[model samples]
Target: MPEKNSSSQLIEPEDALLEAFWTRAKNVAKINPLEVIVGLDSVSALRPSAYSLGDSSEEADRLCKLVMDGTKRATSSWVASYQAEDAPLPEVGELSIICDGSGTPHVLARTRKVTTVAFQEAGPEIAMAEGEGTFAQWKAEHDAFFRRECEELGIAFDPDGQVLTEYFEVLYSH
Candidate 1:
């Protein structure tokens, strides 16, 4: 596990690996045309970019593995810093690779839905969706997490601030 300064970091896929994977995918495409999804040849073609999931390496690795295992299906973040980072908001039906905190690609995921709600709105429904724990736990943990994040970024944490939530499905495991 490693520590990171950012929630998500983009990775530039290796061309050699991409070409090899494409060749194999192409062969499979011939057999299961429907199974072969397009725009998978190179990771860059997957979406606006491939990214990691958490601010710290250890947490990112844990979360990424959880997502790959289908144990976690949703995640949320403060919209302000996300906007400040200029990262693209997840959109429904977009495919992107998930990398570890160390910036190594680990799995691919397709966004199923996107939601925006205030911090105060983080409740049982979203907590259940996150699969992290109970709503109370989610709220307390998220409040602390966001506060630390705000302190680091020199920003204020507003309980009413919008939080971006994304629900996704694992597309490929590696």
Candidate 2:
């Protein structure tokens, strides 16, 4: 039921299991983000962030499938949420472990691009990149989602608000 491959969704990463997963990815992919990205060798104190996609199990399942199948490589997040939680935006070259709803690691990915755009400016380009439906459908869904999230956080949802869009490439999958 877990979903997501973005560093911004980072929950608390479980170190022991994550280290094992990282080992497997390094062996198979023949690349280590720790070294390639942070200039640190393997087995350092640093570890990739871990997180799930949606708020529910079903959403996680659907989104995870999209990511694994390569149909979805981009994701958008509400900047207000990050501000409320005092979390930084996702950055290029960042690595993350995407987990299923059961909290088991499933994929290793690295961010390739990060852009901040106005909600109203996100159109067909963003929608198509997201591999969702048509631009209209994507807009409607995202608008509703933002509204719901804003309500929960006691923040105003603005179509003109900024959104953090992250484009990532999967490095390995289990």
**Candidate 2 versus the native: TM-score?**
0.81
Relative to the true structure, candidate 1 reaches a TM of 0.72
Q: How many backbone clashes does candidate 1 have?
A: 1
lDDT against the true structure, per candidate, is: 0.68, 0.76
Q: What is the lDDT for 69 in model 2?
A: 89
RMSD of 2: 5.2
Report the lDDT of model 2 for residue 6. 58
Best by TM-score: 2
Q: Which stretches of candidate 2 lie over 4 Å from their true place?
A: 1-16, 33-45
lDDT (Cα, tens digit) per residue for candidate 1, span 1-174: 234345553334454554454444434323233333563434333232456675566777888888877778988888887776676777887666676666666665667999998898766888887777799988998888888777777888888998888888765666
User: Model 2's lDDT to the true fold?
Assistant: 0.76
Among residues 3 or more apart in sequence or in different chains, the pairs in candidate 1 whose N, CA or C atoms overlap within 3 Å are 2-57
Q: Can you give the TM-score per candidate against the true fold?
A: 0.72, 0.81
